[model samples]
Target: MNLNELLTDAVAGAINTLYGMRPSLDIIQLQKTRKDFEGNITLVTFPLLRISKKSPEETGANIGGYLKENTGIVSGFNCVKGFLNLIVSDAYYINFINNSFGNNFYGFKPPDTGAEKIMVEYSSPNTNKPLHLGHIRNNLLGNSLCRILEANGKHVIKTNIVNDRGIHICKSMLAWQKWGNGQTPESSGKKGDHLVGDFYVKFDLEYKKQISELVAGGMQEEAAGREAPIMKEAQEMLRKWESRDSQVLELWEMMNQWVYSGFDVTYKRLGVGFDKIYYESDTYIIGRDTVLEGLKKGVFYQRPDSSVWVDLTKDGLDEKILLRSDGTSVYMTQDIGTAQIRQTDFSPDKMVYVVGNEQNYHFKVLALILDKLGYSWAKGLYHMSYGMVELPEGKMKSREGTVVDADDLMDDMIDTAKAMADELGKLEGLTGLEKEDTYRIIGLGALKYFILKVDPVKNMVFDPRESIDFNGNTGPFIQYTYARIRSVLRKASDAGIMFGEKIPERINIGNKEKSILAILYDFPSVVAEAGNNFSPALIANYIYDLVKEYNQFYHDFSIIKESDGNLRNFRLMLSDMVGTVIKNGMGLLGIEVPERM
Candidate 1:
């Protein structure tokens, strides 16, 4: 049994024997004691002081004495003010690790409690531009959360809603039409997506100029509407492209293909991919008829201009627009349609939208509208909202061109890691190809860890320099710890030491190894908690602490240098188990771990 369980039993026994009515102590948590405290578990006894009608000291002393008399787990108990601190025996720590040594450390075997299938939608990027750091954050959270859910034994379907057709894409088409000297990605020596993205930027610049000239030429801005010269040209291009204007359609298809291809590269590099992809071009109208039906059912109202909207004032928000008067679906309408389609396609117990916190209001309205529309499953839908990733300077602004490009940021990280590896003389044995792969793994590992280590709901600063440090609370540090264990395992293997057989031995209740075992025993709880809360940071923190403990053990204990063969084999097994836990834990976080530093 783990230390927490042992302590829980001890505490409950003490409470039952002292209070005489078997007062329940099942809900009591035996959390790790802070460094300043002498005990490993602290129990606040204030609630019981009044019930017992005794002084705080007397109550604590009574419980403490009871625990000491009844259970071997407690070495001693100290009454510190109103809290009862329980010091556990070193033997319990050793027993905990040895018991969990061969089992799944971080693997989550969720109870077979008949959970409903889940749908997670994330990384809905527009085709007109390359993905930026914001998209990276969204993808990571979505992908990692999907893994977390799946690890919890829930059937999870990951989907991406691609924003492929819109005014933004229309600009790209217009710009390509007007500026085309028939230049291709190959001819321009540019990434296909970036090549298309260049035209997108060009369209915005030119469209702004056109708008300015029209205003200067006495065109009424409001009266001009979406039918102005520049706007009309873009709309015409979209119409023609939709109607299969051979040349226009061909260019559209070609440009979209380039963007998709580029997106695939980025997704593969980042170790993220979706199970299914839904495009706005195809599914935009799925919700349109549904909303219209809602209108007939009096679930939504049509404004005088025929614009469709839902009144959300009852939910403490403004009315949300569903569709324009022109019958084109707005963002909300598209989302509603997407959700309906997913219900039909996967029939999940829940649908999770892993979007940013900026759209907190949007998702609130989404869930409300869905529920009002009479989908019973809507109540189970969740918005896995994550905070923005700001640079040291400030928030990343896409319109102002202050955004960090995903490809560029990843490349920069890999290059930085490679440079550090070279400077540390760690690149001597690695070939060019090995170095390239290592750089990718280590670099992406650092980036993913930095993002995942923080609570998803809290806004965090991404300092690229600080995130790559080898000795701090970073990905590299955990990876290095894993690598060290791996090296020891390899040496044992080379020395003809086989660790396959169980040593049939008890755990060593020594200094740091005992602490290390205690942490390892918490693996099941960590996985369950993280998966249940939809937070990968919990697992990240757990792994980081595990590594820290291992590091201390490595410095203080001798595993390979010990003279006793059985002890060496036992320690090797411990090291092997730690390595397994680290690898599995990191994998769940969507982070890669290198076998070597």
Candidate 2:
């Protein structure tokens, strides 16, 4: 049992003996003692005042006295005002250290023998351009959440919905057809996504010029944009692609393949992947057919322009369109279809979408619409809405070619990691190849930790240099602490000194050691809380605090170099277990911890 549970049980027995009444577990509230106080856990005597029929101090003193003398875990107690702070025995911590030592899955629990799977959807990138900084945050959050969920003993399925169709994609295709002398990824020597993205930017440039020309000819800028020939052609291309016109289909297939190849490379480098991927081209048809089904059942209304929509005014939402007048599907249509397909495939207990906060209403309407169509699973749908992530300079616009491409961002991080590592002489003993691999690990760890440390609902600016720092609650700092512990262990092993998980008969310790044990004991709760809240930031920050505490303990005491053999062995065991938990915690955040920096 944890500290709180153990104290509650002891206090309950004491309450019945003193007041002739046993309190419910709900009435027995306990929290970590305030730092200014001298105890590990504190109980408020105010709640038990009615039964005790006495003043707060008297009630607290009575219970504290009973527990200190009657229980093995309650070493002592201090009553201040109404608060009863109980100092837990050192043996409890020592026992925890011994029991937890050498256990690889110490803080992790296995999934139930038979549990329903939770389906999480993230990294829903468009094929119109390469994945950008926004997409990077999406992928990292999704992947890390999946790991966290698994660590919390849940069966998780990681899925993606690739937005590979529609008007934006046609713009890229049309731009390439107009401006290129038949340039391909091979001929241009550019990554496929970058090549395609260039055409997307090219389309914007020319389309703007057309808008300007029309404005000069006495047309409003908005009207000019609508009347632009390039925009018209792109719209027509979308219709043809939807109808599967032979030539348009061929072109779409070729370009999308190029983009997919490029996306795979980026995903691999970013260390994120999906077990199952749904495509808009496939799901949009299913969505359109489902809309027609809804229309037939009077669940939706058809517009005079031959469009499809659902009026949610009664549900406190505005009308939402499913299909346009031209019989083409919008993003919502395909999303509906994707939801249905996944429901059939996984039959998950819950479905979560990791999208930006901008789409908060979109998801709300989606669930409502699904429920309107009489699907019982609609209630299980959730939107894990998050705020935007921007660099220090400012926001990014994808159409204007100003977005930071995922590939480019990762390359910058790795390169910056190399420069900093070299400057600090961190890779002194490693071979050339090992150094390269370590650079990648450090770079990506920095990127992931920087993004994951912030609360999901907050919009924040990401600074590359700030993230890769070797100190101040950063990834490298925690990693270096782990490496330091490993160095100490390695030296002990080399000198033929051994440390085992067995508890020593008598070993000297201090408050610092007890404090470290307290931190270690929090791992299971932290993991569970992170999973419950769908926030990997919880795990990231917890690991940082653990590293910080371990560092303080390292500096204040002697481990391998201590003269006392029992003390030395005990400290070694503690250091090793902390390192193990550090690795396990970092693993849940989808980060790597190196033995040496």
Candidate 3:
């Protein structure tokens, strides 16, 4: 048990012996004592005033005295108003360190057999464009959540639903066919996704030009947009592709394959992947079948134009379209089908969709529709909605070709890391290859950490320069601290110092040493909290706080140079534990920390 649980049980015993009443666990309010106070755990005695039949101070003193006298755990106590601050004996912390130190998986729990499985769906990228800043945040949050959840001992399945077949996809294909004289990724010498993305932009530009001309010729803007020749052609292409026209299907398959190849490269570079990938083309038909079945069962209604929809007015939502009038399935249909497919495959206990906040209403309607369709697992579906990520310049527009491509952003971060490291002379002893690899680690670490350090629900601006800084709460700062700890341990080992065994029991540990131990004790709880809240920012910030504290402790104390063997060994072991926790925490964030920098 942790310190708090031990103290709680002691308090419960004290309460029963003194007051002749058994209190619920909720009545035992134990918290970390404030820094200004002289204790490790503080109990609020105000809640027990009625049972004590005394004032707050008297109640606190009674409990404090009882704990100190009855239990060996409490070394001393102080009554500050209604607060009972109990100081734990040095032996308690020493015992904690002895038991916990040298444990590489100190904070992680192995998954139990027959655990509830959670499926997390993220990076639902449309095949028409390469990933950008927004997708980066999505992937990082989703990927980190998986790690955090697994750390909490849940079986997590990472998944992606590729938006491969849609009108937007047709826009790129048609543009490629009409404008390009048989150009391909190889012929254009560009990444396949980038090439396909260029055509998407081209289609938008031509469509806008057509709209402007039609409006100038006395047509309404909406009418012009719907009637534009390119828009008509793209819609027709979608219909042909749906009908399995050999030529259109062949083109669709070829372009989607190219996009898939490009997406794999990006996902690998971003350190995110999926156990299963569902395509819109494959799931839409299942959705159509399901919706048609729902219609026959009166779960849905058909409009005069023959479109299928579900009325969610009773659930405080408006009607949601399941299929267009021409029998093409909408996004909602594919999502329903995808959820069913996943349920059949994994039988997950929970289904999580890691999409942005803009689709909030869409998911809400989806859950309601699925419940109406008699899927009991619909209630378990969760939307891990996050806000958008923008650069310092402003919001990005994909169709305008103004978004920062994920591949380009990663390259820029690495280059910036190299420049910063070079300017600071951090790469002096490293060979060219080592320097490059270190730069990549620092660069990618910075990118992932900066984006994830924020609460996922809040929109924020990303600055590359600020993220790579070596002195703040940035990833490199924590990474550098870890490297420093490793260096110290190496020197200690070379000097024939042994840290494999626990320190001598009689050794005295100061408050700084105890403080590090306290934080280390909180790692498992922090991981649990991160999992419970589904927020990686908690883990990110926890590591930052730990690193910050360790840096102060390092500056204030001597480890390898200490004259006392026990003291030096204790400090070295403590430092090693801190480094291990740091590496483990960063690993949960899908970031790598260099051993030497």
Candidate 4:
């Protein structure tokens, strides 16, 4: 057990002995002692006063006296007001460091065989465009969440649902058919997604021009938009594709394949992958059938125009459409189908949709509809809603071709990393290939860290320059500290010093060493908290605080240069543990630390 657990049981025992009443574990409130106080663990005596029948101070003094006299765990005690602060002996900390210093996976728990399986769905991108900064945040949050959950010994399946069909996709297909004289990704030398994305933009431009002409001819804006020739063509294309028209189906398959190829490159660069991928084309038909079943079962109602919908008004939401009058499925219908298909395939304990906050209502309705459809597992569906990420310039617009493409943004980050590293001369003595590889790691690390460090629910303005800086709570700062620790250990190894053995049983550990051990002891809890809350920001900030503390301890004392062999080895072991925790923590955030940055 850790120090807190040991103290909790001791306090419980003391309460039972002193008050002649057994106190529950919850009543024994233990917290870290205040910074100004000279103790490691503080117990609030107010709760025990009910059983002690004494004043607060008297109760605290009685508990403190009992702990000190009865247990080897508390060597000294001080009562501050109604709080009893217990100071542990140096031997406890020395033993803690010795036990934990050699553990490589110090804070990680092995997967529990009986744990429930969780499926995390993220990066549900449309085939119409390449992923952008918004998609980057979505992918990173999903990927990091998987790592955190796995660290907490949970079984997590990373999944994606590609919005590869619908009217939006038809716009791009129509544009390619009209303007492109049989051009291909091979001929244009552009990523398939980017090429397809260009056509999406082209469709918008032409659609707008047609709208303007119709409006000039004295038609209402909405009427002109519906009547636009290109819009009509795209709508017809969607119908043809849905009917499995051979020509349209061939074109759709070819374009989608190209986009998938491009998407693979981006996913690889971002260091994320999916165990399974679902497509709208495959799921929409299932959704249509599910909707018809819901209608027959009276779970949903059909309008006079023959469109199907669910009345969520009783549940504080307006009615949501399931199928259009033309018998085409809406996004909600596709989602319902996807949920059913996934549950059948995985039988997961929970289905988490790592979507943006904008879709909060969508998931809410989805869960309600699933429950209404008689699926008992509907309650297990959760929406991991996250806030949007924007550049300093403003929000991005895909149809206007104004968004930061994911591939381009990664390239820019790498270029910025190279420039900054060269300016700092941190890349000296590295080969051309090493410099290239290091730049990629540092660049991607900075991007992922800066984004993941923020609360997922809060909107963030991503500044590439600020993210790559080597100082102050940034990824590079933490990475640089890790690299510094690694350098020290390497030099110690070169000097024929080894830290594989434990520290001596009677070694003296100063306050700095004790403080580092305390933080290390809290690593597992920090990871568990992050997993429970689905927030990587918890892990991100925890590592930063640990790194900051280690840097201070490094400046205040010597490690390998210490005169005493035991003290020197202890410091080296402490440094090694910090480095291991740093690596593990960064790995949870899907960021890598270099040994020599």
- CA lDDT, every model vs. true structure: 0.81, 0.89, 0.90, 0.90
* Candidate no. 3 TM-score: 0.97
Whichever of 1 and 2 has more lDDT, that candidate is: 2
The per-residue C-alpha lDDT of model 4 at residue 267 equals 97
User: Which residue pairs of candidate 2 clash?
Assistant: none
Between candidates 1 and 4, name the one with more favorable TM-score: 4
| Model 3 Cα lDDT, one tens digit per residue, 390-417 | 7777888665556877999899888988
Error of 3 at 473 (Å): 1.3
290-358: candidate 2 lDDT, tens digit per residue: 999999999999999999999999999999999899888888899899999999999998999999999
Compared with the true structure, model 4 gives a TM-score of 0.96
Which residue window of length 10 is worst by lDDT in model 1? 500-509
Q: Per-prediction count of colliding residue pairs?
A: 0, 0, 0, 0
- Model 4, 182-267: lDDT tens per residue? 88999999999999988989999999999999999999999999999999999999999989999999999999998999999999
- Candidate 1 CA-lDDT value: 0.81
TM-score winner: 3
